[model samples]
Target: MLLDALVNTTDAVASTRSRLAKVEALAGLLAQLEPDEIAPAVGFLLGKPRQGRVGVGWRGLSAAMGAPAAESSLTIADLDALLDRLAEASGAGSAGDRSRELGEFTALATEREQDFITRALLGDMRTGALEGVLTDAVARAADRPGDVVRRAAMLSGDLGETARLALTGTAEELDAVGLVVGRPVLPMLAATAASTSAALETTGEASVEYKLDGARIQVHRAGDEIRVFTRSLADITHRVPEVVEVVRNLPVRDVILDGETLSLDEDGAPRPFQETMSRFGADAARETVLHPWFFDILHVDGRDLLDEPLSTRLAELERVAGAHRIPGEVTADPEVAERVSRDAIEAGQEGVVVKAIGSPYAAGRRGSSWIKVKPVHTFDLVVLASEWGYGRRKGWLSNLHLGALDPTGEFGEPGGYVMVGKTFKGLTDELLRWQTEYFPQIEVRSSAGTVWVAPTTVVEIAIDGVQRSSRYPGGIALRFARVKRYRDDKPASEADTIQTLRALLRE
Candidate 1:
């Protein structure tokens, strides 16, 4: 198929807000692809390339730019081959070679194709064709159930391959794609709850496990060979040999365990999250060893336990890795659940996760089967600046610059606020318009897309937690921040202190 056809379909998909329209457009495009082209076509439509990260940055792309071709002549096969060559380039003069190749390739693409290529290369396909929409499109085109398609995609951890199999192969073949011993599958995720009592009321007879403040690890072992993967399914077997050795020592011949890994202090308490991340990202650091704590098992021997309930999986985990299991219990009483949550917090852990006893594993997506309850801290913060919006939010003030009161003058001028992070989430159309109208009245300066305002307007913001950072002057940043409302009655001096946020990080 010609590359223009796919680009045109992507444009159509992005140009609409209706879910049905997007699915129809994607299904129509999928129907026209050949068997061998289905995988790459789906990848491109999803705003991803088969060859990952070809070392092409904005500077490289800008330097390689040439005038677009008057007509479209490039084929899907041709584009895929060019990307393959670019991904394979390395060593001496690789940057120049990549730039030359990108220039040659971009010169053959039309203007619309160039626009699509830029977004795809930048990993920002902003198209409405996200994973959920594309999965529905696949089901519609293949005459299969959405659940079946989702399971195949999650188990294989590759939507493009799943698309190809669903379109060209039989349903039985798709179902046969089970968990391999050394291959990584998408880990299950948890939903959030306001409190443990509410979570227990929703999911009766629940298992409340301590939510650790560490990185997620999925270990796959078969005899002496062992492989470890992160939550996003990145293979990191070489970085942590200690984890590999521990999994290799398990009694089971073949097993897949899902757990968390973190560094512990001399007192056996979990280290700071920043320290754990630093150790996790290191290529080789044998001095600081990471300990693994298993919570669930996905597979044991040749039996696949993914279809089993949480109780069954826990039993299998106890038999295989009882020594490394996290602390938890099964109960329906809200009082017990709250007690466990309290204990977890007292032990310097994050919080507790309440899970339904009979729910099977839902991979790659956050479902309500398992819910987490953590202490949410909200503070009155100052809005320093705002940025222009895009897409449906165009012509409006959207993303806000959030600051914490720095009273000690530790970072800069006396009584001046310090920037922690920026957030564009949890804003409705009314809030967007309100900011667009009210912010300029307090504006101190304006730029091309951003407006700087006096730090007099205080707004209430909620955050999951805080993390240590070097990018901001205060040395801390918020996680999953969202605006609750504008605190018009509060003064800048009454805003939350930088010390308060940094204290949360220490917890």
Candidate 2:
């Protein structure tokens, strides 16, 4: 199939608000693809390339200029092969080679194709379609159960391959994509609750485990061989030799364990999250030794425990990891759950995760089987600017750029605000409309898509916590920030200060 066909389908998908319409459009497009073309097409429509990052960034692509093709001639196979070659470029002067290759490819692409290619390269197509939406579309196109397709995609760790099998292969093939000892599957995620009592009220009998403030690691061990993957399934086995050694020493010969890895101080308290992240990505000279705490088991000694309940999985995890298992208690009592959560916080941990004992591992999706309760931090911040919205929010000013007061001139000018982060979450349509009309009234300047506003608007912002940052002037940024409401009565002078956020870095 031609690349033009897939690009047109993606355009149609982005032009609608109804999810069912998007699924129907994508499913119709999938039905028309050849068996071999389905995989690459699926990847492209979902704003990802099967070849992964092609060594091209916005600067590289925007710098290269070429005349567009008068007609569409690039095939899906042709583009995929070009990307494969681009991914292979490396070593001395590989940048020039990649630029040359990208220049040639761009010359053959029309203007519309160039737009699609840019979005695909940046991994932000804004098509309102992602893995979850495409999974449903694939199921509808292949006449298969969505649950079966989702499970296969999660286990195989490749949505493109799963779509290919569902479209061209049999049901047995989909079922065969089970747990493999050395391959990583998507980790189960948790929903949030106000407290342990609220979470226990939802799930009668639960396992309350301490939530670690560290990086997520999925370790797979077979004999002496072990592979460690991140939450996004990127293989980082070589980065942390300490993790490999720990997994290899486990009692079980073959197993897939889900856990968190972090560096602990001499007192056995978890370090700051930045310290853990620093050790996780270091290529050599691993100074800060990371310790892995096993929380759940997916496969143990050739036994597939994905379909089993949380109780059975925890039992297997305990037997396999023993002392390495995460500390937790099984109870239906609200008081016990509250005590456990409080103890976790006192130990320098994040919070507690209350999980349903009878819930199976629902990978890749954020189901309600698990609940996380954590303490929230809220502050009154000033809105520095706002960016124009996209898709459904095209006309309104969305995505607020937040800033905190700097009284001591620690970051730039005295008595000015320093940008901490940006957030578009927790904004309703009413708030969007209000900002659209109100922000420009106090606009300091307006540009292509952003409007710089006066620092008079104080807004209440909630965050998970703060993290060390090099991009922000205060050397810290808000983690998971969202708008609570506009603090209309407050002034920018009374807003929270950078010192307040820096204090969280110590905690």
| Each prediction's whole-model lDDT (CA) | 0.82, 0.84
Off by over 4 Å in 2: 377-507
Give TM-scores for every candidate, taking all chains together and pairing residue i with residue i.
0.77, 0.77
CA RMSD for every model? 12.5, 12.4
lDDT of 2 at 159: 91
Score residue 229 of candidate 1 by CA lDDT: 89
RMSD of 1: 12.5
Predicted model with the maximum TM-score? 2
Task: Give the candidate number with the greatest lDDT.
Answer: 2
What is the Å distance of residue 381 in model 1 from its true position?
18
Candidate 1 C-alpha lDDT tens digits along 77-98: 7778888988999999998898
